[model samples]
Target: MYAIHSVLAGLLAGSASMSALEVKSEVGRSGEDGIFQSKGIPSPATNDAATSANFKLLSGMADPNGASLDVLHDGRIPRSEDDPRSNFFFAGGSNGGRILVDLGKVIDVSSIATYSWHPGSRAAQKYQVYVADGSAEGFSAELKEDADPTKAGWEKLGEVDTSGEQPGQHAARLSPAKGKSLGKCRWVLFEVRKNPNAGPFNDTFFSEIDIIDAAGPELVRIERPKKVIRQFGSKHGNFRYTLDVSAAPDLEEWCAEHLIPVMDEWYPKIIEMLPVEGITAAESITFTLRNPADLPQNLRGVPAYASGNSVVFNADFMRRQQTGEAIGAGVHEVVHVVQFGGTREKSARQRGRANRPPSWVTEGVADYIRWFLYEPQSKGAEITRRNFDRANYDGSYRITANFFDWVIRNHEKDLMRKLNVATHDGYSDDLWKEWTGKTVQELNDGWKAYHKKKLGL
Candidate 1:
């Protein structure tokens, strides 16, 4: 009986050991800030190793032919069916592509895993991995059409040909196809070319790539991008755009230097303020600076206006940027482009109300975003002591903008966004009641009273 008890204990211990190993190999874990919790796992790159955690999509990630939508997010997971949109693409009917991923720092790389997908094609996945030390002899940290990554002193660590890989995306393990080990490198340059050995229909859809070492995995710290991306104005291409300066030749240089950056910075903010369906049409937004002499007197006084897909600015208004009066005009105009309420959606029930958000509300909304959100330090929306008596919230521009800011700070945190949706889809003052449980008039009166008390008026 004593010998039988000993045997049972030994069996139990072996089962527990097997379970721990399985968890370590299959579940690659990560934490809040770029820290891998792999803890000596055999496959450390299994978790978010290629996406947000262990690695970063650096400056040089591009296909000679542009890759598909949301490359970073799509490439975040290996064949993540959770989001149909999460697949990085290369142009259709192309052979294959290249992408540079930054590991944030130099480390010994023991293994890597490449994951990809295609709808129905059974093209074998043939690829090469080139390791770089993040020096002059490495792949560019900035994306450029003329970039030649091959000229750099990149060492071919290995090649992987998953010709036996099933019809579409399959799991490819991390073992060098050429060299012994990748040694220590900061960037992994992945190249996939059409194999002369395979038949036609060899296009590729890249999913994810992960690099790992024996010590385990560690996430490429996200905040570290500021060291490289900030100087290059990484926000520059947030929008795909085109410029039409045919009308205003004098404004060409200024538009390239100032206008483009401002639009890129603010367009994202406006998009975040709306629901997915509220996105602006896919048409490229044209920025047309009209010749000063041709400008109408009424429009001449205005800095810029959003007309269809175009944001037109008078040459005179472009010059006002020197005095900082029109520094945020692009922001204000693009806000109009993004605010598509009454036009995009209007049922008979909404149209019968025949109530549009007051012109003051729309203009006031623009100024509030410019003054309160974009450049608060400008104090552009301050209701000064001299104008205190006439400072009705309906006065528009700075006056109404001040009231809008108050509502955002005190009552409804997302007032501007809600107000925009309400006005765009058949506006009425009742929206104020729905948002704050008070009439617009009551909110105005309360705001004035608070200001009067604080200013000792």
Candidate 2:
């Protein structure tokens, strides 16, 4: 059995081992500040030498003989005070809070195993593990849900049973097939089902997580010369993307300094706007650079595409686009990644045939973030309220985007937050009533009046 050390010792060991390695992370605060920051643990680039056996040990890597902290019980349910990394309360109240682990420089990970205590009763806690393919866009949950590896882009190894498990300690393991290969993975996630004041908090607490790697095996190698590089924003299982200097001598450093941080800020805003359940951080996600020819004919700005759980962008856009205040066309394509659902169930639901969101609302939200969060002052009010005439609420693209902007400025603290949860077709009058205590017409009339007063028309 693998001998486990204390978390502090593991952190120290991991940090010491990393002294000679470069630690890459985006530096910025999420849109909202809180006690815990969603910072990426430092990860080194993938190479031949960084295999599982060679990587330094972490405190949490092995199983513990006892619980990490004293459990406080209300009746039989136990609650442990939060610790910096493992505590439950550290998770932000947002519905999609996640934990990601960067298998820095490690290769040939045959499998991963984790055990977490079910917080309520075993039956009430449902958990799943996700694996991102290396890109931040594409990922796969447990295998049975996605039997066809080619279709889902990943093979779900297996699963854990929470039934009758204790609330204080739990564990599970993922060991891929003998020949399967692994690389620099971002995490081995433990996701628990959450419900409102199921406040004995119906989730799981992790006591241990383990990684099983081939003692030695061949690795997947990236052989092509670097021509284009793309960076992505990921949350839950979805992605948003951006690209940086491709042929530059210092490509990685350039991305860390300029592109990555900006993508980090934009991430939470997009998640708040649109949410997906059933995905986690540990799974494989892809963010790649593709030719402009890859995009659908209907889109614009050197077109970027997100599918196959990966994002591909027009390299020419990054090579030649003029510098402006906002994230350019590159970031626009990244948003599409988040729109794809993990399974047929989610895809069918998102197709929204019965409750389809208006073209205006869908595209408008995308456009709003392009300017508001990524490029705050690029064109100013040129894209603001003036174009939101009463007749244009149903108008598409920029026109509707302007209208949505108007509603937020005139009513909700920031329409982005309210519009985040807005449904597709049901947006008619009830949405306005629910948001502003006014019907759609009342809201539009009020907005037009507000704009007119501003112009002194």
Candidate 3:
């Protein structure tokens, strides 16, 4: 588990006040880093880029690592958002909890031209630099005394000097080599070395650290302020909460037992699929578990919307509709949350008809993760696409999901990510051409042939 190190509140004195800043990068607008996590690279609600970066501040122990760091040993975390992005990290005494930085859902490593780390209350404690390209859990860390930025490739860029150390503060600079080549990378990790002479470890404090050349984009406020609620996170990577419900004393325990870890399972991969310039996953989301009545007009919040770093949901619907299925539905809504937003709805018929997503794509993709991560066998039951007769890709959730399942199973596994990135326009057989080198008809034919051979269908 990642530990939380507390610095004298000075480090965060101005943190909450620092609004989201975009960092223009060599990777183009789609590749910049530091936007909010809940909001997509470009928000899906208004279908535009509203915020510049996805910046997330997490307590060390509160990190996704504590719950599933083991995923790293398998050479990949469940999703990219699970990757850490804090350029600065700290530890108290020897065994004190740690204070670490994670990028959440931002992109572009080289864009961070310069950075400084000031460890509060110590001249120095041994530390190391870690790196990963989203292929493994934690980081392949490099321990040393200093880091050098001008190097030719990925190596320790700088080191901190902590000889004859005293309590107060210490700082260091990471080499350009360390931050530059990250253009092709995914996550950066750091850890504090243990001190043998220290007493019972308490907490470690951190001072303010800064990044240069990280601002990009302009803010477009689509609507006014409304009531907000959050999904309080748990130690097991389960972010749980009840919105607007009269809290049942047993709700917490019930949620602990039932709330699915669908997002926790998918976030890391989403981060990997995102452009480097975009925000890390955590920075891209604003988890709220509140009621719609708590909101101003009960606008239904656009089904599920993300205009900037914030993702709003109508919790009232979830609670009232509570069932074993709500978990999967919530996961589906959350996919929309992280994907920015779904297509626009101009009318009830349009909402239910033309404006609707193809059933296989819409539901299958969601169920892919929901079932694979939470209920694998049940997911198998949902993968049967009965509508292969396909006129205009009948816009139904279950059927579309089934087709999507077939697409993923028979063709490219990365297809879901490609579809997600391009949903800003629309998803159709044309998308199949762009991604799988086949038309929807061709894909359907191939899928049918493959399945018939396998199941003797």
Best by TM-score: 1
Off by over 4 Å in 3: 1-253, 256-266, 273-323, 341-364, 380-396, 424-431, 449-457
Model number with the top lDDT? 1
TM-score for candidate 2, please give it. Answer: 0.39
User: Tens digits of per-residue lDDT for model 3 on 151-203?
Assistant: 21222322333323343332233324222322323334344444332454312
True-vs-predicted CA distance for residue 19, candidate 1, Å: 99
| Least accurate 10 contiguous residues by lDDT in model 1 | 1-10
lDDT of 1 by residue, 344-396 (tens): 43344333335668878888888898888888999988877888899988999
The 10-residue segment with the lowest total lDDT in model 3 = 6-15
Give per-model TM-scores. Answer: 0.45, 0.39, 0.35
Worst lDDT window (10 residues) for model 2? 5-14
* lDDT of candidate 2 at residue 2, scale 0 to 100: 16
How many pairs of residues collide in each model? 6, 30, 78
